[model samples]
Target: MTKFASLKSVRLAGAAAIALLAGAAQAQNSPPGAEMATEAYLRAIQEKNPVLHAVIAVNPHAKADARALDAERKAGKIRSPLHGAPILLKDNIESNDGTATTAGSLALKDNVPGRDAPLVKRLTDAGLVILGKTNLSEWANIRSNHSISGWSAVGGTVRNPYVLDRSACGSSSGSGAAVAAGLAHLAIGTETDGSITCPAAINGLVGLKPTVGLVSRTHIVPISHSQDTAGPMTTTVEDAAKVLTIIAGSDPADPATNDADAHKTDYAKGLSKDALKGVKLAVARFYTGYSPKTDAVFENALKDLRAQGAILVDVKDFDEAPIGKAEGLVLNTELKADMAAYLASTDPTKVKTRTLADLIAFNAAEPKEMVWFGQETFEKAEKTKGLSDPDYLKALADSKRLAGPEGIDRILKETGAAAIIAPTTGPAWTIDPLNGDNYGGSSTTLPAVAGYPHLTVPMGDVTGLPVGLSFIGPAWSEKLLLNLGYAYEQATHHRKPPAFRPTVAP
Candidate 1:
């Protein structure tokens, strides 16, 4: 049975508005063109956004851009299967469109560069419409340790579409919620660690954090230069693969992506339903068993994989304490350095928070910025001596060594497994401002710290909330992981559209 059938149907209250708009737009004699599709989404946002707060700004040029793409199609040009499809950019990613890349902060509300990030350029070149920018955790959730995941000063909090009171986990929250709710076909989200995958899992979407250097991190707001990368967040693994194909190439401005051109490929073409058959997958048992409900769902998913002829290997004992300890130091040290560099790149008049100290003072003065939480994390980053400091350097080297060579690599070699599997995270927790995020479990650190690829696909729900199955692989293994995820996704058919229930009692 399809997993969704067994799940209760709690229909969204505001869905009629979008449904009516979709029907009215496509009810015409001719096929619904890009213009019509853009219009429908624009109208959908108007009717549904007040409740969800998913989108920060709608692109003023979206209709005009769609019309242009339609004219091109009429003139015998179709860039790809996704040509003219509307996609949202997480507010941290800059685009040439009129929308400001605010990073969900009131401080950078007017910090519009009016230039596309290299990845955004690639998407536009492929004829994808820039529908708008979506909200996010303020400053990508780096300001405070006690920060709320989906709340932001500029765009407000992003509500999970599955259950309105649930948290849409971190940084990429709006992008995840918007795509899951059908606000857009896909969205681009940046991740320093679990930012992309967490929100994607909680919101019941497919999120792929590619090998760090595979996609350029040129114009997105900074967190950690060594770890940050932009990736696709979509409802389907195929859509994520398609977006990765377009965006995976070298950018001259980003030194990290120097080898990207050599590694890039048509990722979507490599997918096969039989890819998982006879493949040995290492199950990261340490990452599971946090929530019994989530583990139960994962066990059923494992059964589905086994039924498909995949071999599951159990390798349970690995200590993750050193990696976690080292990662915090590396992130704090790099954030101070990378943030200053990015701020310097911005126009001086538009962005006044030119240094970490400047941002700290701004938050101190602005009541809205500090009303919900404090900027203790930012202050700690400011106190770090420099990226060149001995302790910081030691932490950086130690983290990479522990997470990459001694970590995922050693496990794979010992098990002779193609990849590692884990529960991406537990189901979405309640949105709480008083105490901040209460995570049940996460398997994001190994892949994230190692700068390897991690793909998360919806496995099933815990109660009324969704959880994701994670595939973790070595560097530049995005294609392999995608194929594996696609195979599992096709076999299970697990993804379900959100019901937008007010809350789940359990």
Candidate 2:
């Protein structure tokens, strides 16, 4: 039997071995129960977070919220699967519970919007406790090309839970690390391209970037409207699915989400261990072979999939189709327009910097924000013509068509497959303040720009670091992806809790 099968047999034997394994798999904090786990996480945040720097603020109301949820449960009122579960939000997502949504920049330190983002509201409505906000890349890594992945003036650097000195990846770095380290059961992370998947892969977590507009973006900080999305980062596929079920729906305020209510469903309801049986999955080989170790892990994952009765088809050199070249222009144009509109909508007294130009000036005046990286992207964005520019319009249209209809859609059509799979990214590299992030090959761009669903599940480890296998599908295919991920997770059980080591052992 395989090692995972042996573990399953051991777990079936009794509670003693299971308890022992659970203790070993507890990462930085043990999970005794929800309440106890919350307390332990809070304690860890106080004791160990100085070095990890994963959390920017702790919710003073977390305990109270948990208590309220407990009372509701005792009264026989279970709200959802995540009822009473403590969840961390990336600091870019606004919440009204006295925590500021800073987006890891000093300029927005006092910019409390005094309301929860609509997606946040959905999570809260499902009885998930807000455990406070975690740090992210400064301005979601858009302010500077040279900016470090996990560093921000407000939150320092978020360390990888598996290796303290390694990069956590960003701009959802803290959310990934915190969930992997057992700081929280779940976290909400925003992604424009690789922000959610990269960090989730490196930190050994399951991340699901839902179809853009599946979750409302209202009151969340802006990026490119075409590609931006908030997703769930969790330790398990089941938890990610549960969170997605709660958060996915249409919001009247966000016009982009008009179709979401029709698409959203109970994503976790039909998960089965035999989900991959007879399923045809196209393998996107573009990102493979970058690292022999990562490639080996991926090969083993393929073996596991085949063992589970999945039919894999190799699709080499998937057409990127000028998507990369056009992506920057679209983002730059939208960043200038979207950011200015968001800032203007905020309370003027609370957000003094009402435009991207104002933010550029604020950063120039603040030495701490520019200590490691300058705002070159911000400067370029400021110089862009308004969204009416023909170049901007053409770039957006071209990028969407290439990445969506003619790219992922074409691949799916040709392969006659339900989804495409690839390595999410290589393992974490050493954190470098002076040099910034050194990311390896990634499969996040096409699905991200296509506004499609992308799910990453921990495939296995390379050396001592973790890697993930991605499942990308057309829009509103979250349910199909989640089912496949859940099957793979059950078969391999590749995810292990982080040890919080100082570094990889030589």
Candidate 3:
């Protein structure tokens, strides 16, 4: 029997128990008002974060930032809806706040960035409080193929709030768990492939993997420039839209975002319960069938979509042969080139390891970081010929073309659909130290590699664990995806706060 099935016997009573516990927890931890005061949120972080291991460091100036925003609001100079809202950031993203931007690795424990990343500046300018930096898989899960998703030497392992022993699904694990556990109003998570959406899905939150370049990646730790972007992870789709609007704009330092201002808008204004009306959505069933419980949840979501006035068209699968074969080559080649550039930009005094080679050597010298997994992926990336190689060029062209124009774009054009829907991923698995992540099915790759927009919303729970339904579209289709996600979220109201269970009891 499958894991989902094995847990079904205890699901009904377990869910009720979880709900009661969650309600009590929330009541005990509730803030003074509708919007949590930044001080109260920080106190909660201090009380709850040790057990959760979600936050790596608390921003020493967060209380002051929140007070400043409150003063602006009282002065009738409110910058945006996010004004005074507490926000957590993934550790890989740099901030001018006193905390170091460690990618959960000890080598950069003192890598305190002098300036905020462009995206961080945009959000702070709009008045969001930088609560703290959250933990992530060391080096964004690129150091080792067998690495634990939420384990890092700096922050230890991030525990799932729903079930403490289960995987939180990195490298956005801490961001997802923090928001779900109400440690903050919102959090920023960076994705390359399933990093953002997978964690969001497993943790029962809304996550958007915006089109690459829509959000500036300047100053973030690099994996692949072709596929990396920071996005919002929130308990509500409306909150995700609000955060996205603030961060989506042109950045002079990042040339890829030169045209971003044209595509940017107040995404929150586009949300409506009737937004799904007259919309044609295609069902991408390719990612289903991994877990029966997940598929069941997805099927019910389709029904909810149809009830919301959406026309659902069935598209079994898209041809993804070329994308799978060339993706590794593109990522490996870019990692060597992009990481060197990012490291070069860091303060030499704060960062001792200056390049990919330097990082590999540092890991070898410090064996504690590799106690659970070897640096096989890093070794492979180090051996790759730099970006100028013919192999790298061919792989990049093939992967992008197939994942974009010939894959997601073709399906939308041929099927006359505005967006496609699929299961974001299966439920969170047991975190195994002996092996690595036992990821089941996932639908993030096509949109991730194609540089398209993908949003995951809480669909339902399977044996007391959360699952997410994904909406994907062509580049710059974030508005459409958010609207659809908002509509579905309203109709179903599937999200439930985590109960912080020890495990799935039988």
User: All candidates' TM-scores?
Assistant: 0.94, 0.93, 0.93
Q: lDDT (0-100) at residue 13 of candidate 2?
A: 31
Which numbered prediction scores highest in TM-score against the true structure?
A: 1
What does candidate 1's lDDT look like per residue over 1-506, in tens digits?
14323222212322332243234333433343677667767766775678889999999999999888777766667787677778899999999887888888878988989899999999999988899999999999999989999899999989998998999998899999988877877899989989999999999999999999999899989999889999999988998999999989999899999989888999999699999999999999999878889999999999999999999999888899999999999999999999899889898899988988998998999999988899999999999999779999999999999999999999999999999999999999888989988987699999999999999999999877999999999999999999999999999988898887888884
> Who wins the lDDT comparison?
1
| Tens digits of per-residue lDDT for model 2, 288-355 | 87777999999999999999999999998966748988999889889999999889878887889999
What C-alpha lDDT values do all the predictions have? 0.88, 0.86, 0.86
Model 2 misplaced stretches (Cα beyond 4 Å): 1-34
TM-score, structure 2 vs. true = 0.93
* Cα TM-score of candidate 3: 0.93
State in Å the error of residue 111, model 2.
Answer: 1.3
**Per-residue lDDT for 75 in model 1?**
66
